[model samples]
Target: MKFKIEFSGHENIRSNHQKTIEITKESHLTPQGDCIVGVNANHACADLPQDLKEKLKNPDSKITFSIDVGEHNFTIEGKGHPDLILTHDEDIVIRKSDFVCPRTLAVKCDKASDLLPREMVSMLQDPKTKGTFTITVD
Candidate 1:
């Protein structure tokens, strides 16, 4: 099977952030069941001031967005935070929901440490990092 990844968010946030993503299938029967979505504004917005970059690097930092595939739409709020010290190119996996099958999805925030608070790390590591709610069919 084939799948597509889509992202929707504030114009400023979506255009000024960097994200690395990945997807893997959990079921053996569906070899093509998984799909990956990676996005980043690290080098793209390099001209921005240092302070702006710092704000975008926070692990606790979040970008309100939505993901859509087929007839299913998933709303993700407050994403981009991670408990672990993710490297520049690390993949932050996203948890599966009713709209999507059991697949591992990952996302990495480029230079997120500079923006992320140390205390917030632990909270972002959970499988459900984002307080996502299904807006459409699950």
Candidate 2:
């Protein structure tokens, strides 16, 4: 199953969080929200397709996220846990740990915000930058 989200960059994006990466529907961000790489998201965690969400609740499912910003592309791989509720109204978060929450998309991710290329992070600091993220379960 698959789901997709479109979002844009924010001026305050730091992409410095060590354990997670996030995208949110909120229009603004503070430097403290270092995990948030994109804002003004078109779809939140709760907006994921039912089939996709269903797969996300299976502990044996592996998930892949394709991150695209301008011409740059990146991939993040993680596992879905049975604890996933996929009910957050405004955010989609991918974590490098086992922590589960309403906002969590996938846990034990192979990459966190801090692991993204600095050049890509720099480009994402511009509010004019747009991004597309696709999530797939296989």
Candidate 3:
């Protein structure tokens, strides 16, 4: 099977001062599994605000990132994990059931909308939230 992933929007909500990184779709991919594991390679270092840069750079600091991956609207939090481990980051993979089926046959992201703040009890409740983007499996 194969799936196409699309990232819509993301925000960093560690301190009261909220920092965000809006990314347009760079590319999409489909892996053999029902879901594919995607690691934000630059999640730890890039697209961060200057004020938060140093703290995020700390190897001991727990830095988590949220992204709307190709309609699978979900956030992956990095907890006690190094930003560079090529395999460890692959632990969480987004799969088909994560999204509303049939309606969203292909995944896509807005890059301008879709923001999930930390205060929210559920990331899935955000209004800017669009249902998980879908992909074809074959």
For each candidate, what is the lDDT?
0.27, 0.91, 0.27
Candidate that beats the other on TM-score, 1 or 2, i.e. the better one: 2
Candidate 2 residue 15 Cα shift, in angstroms, is 0.5
Across residues 54-122, which tens digit of lDDT does each residue of candidate 1 receive?
A: 443444555433443334333443333223222323223333221221121222323222232322323
What TM-score does prediction 3 earn?
A: 0.25
User: Residues 89-127, candidate 2, lDDT per residue (tens digit)?
Assistant: 999999999999999999999999998887888889999
**What order do you get sorting by lDDT, best first?**
2, 1, 3
Could you tell me every candidate's TM-score relative to the true structure?
A: 0.25, 0.97, 0.25
For model 1, what is the error of residue 98's alpha carbon versus the real structure, in angstroms, after optimal superposition? 22
| Clash number by candidate, in order | 17, 0, 4
lDDT of residue 100 for candidate 2: 96
Per-model RMSD to reference = 16.4, 0.8, 16.0
Candidate 1's TM-score? 0.25
- Which candidate number maximizes TM-score? 2
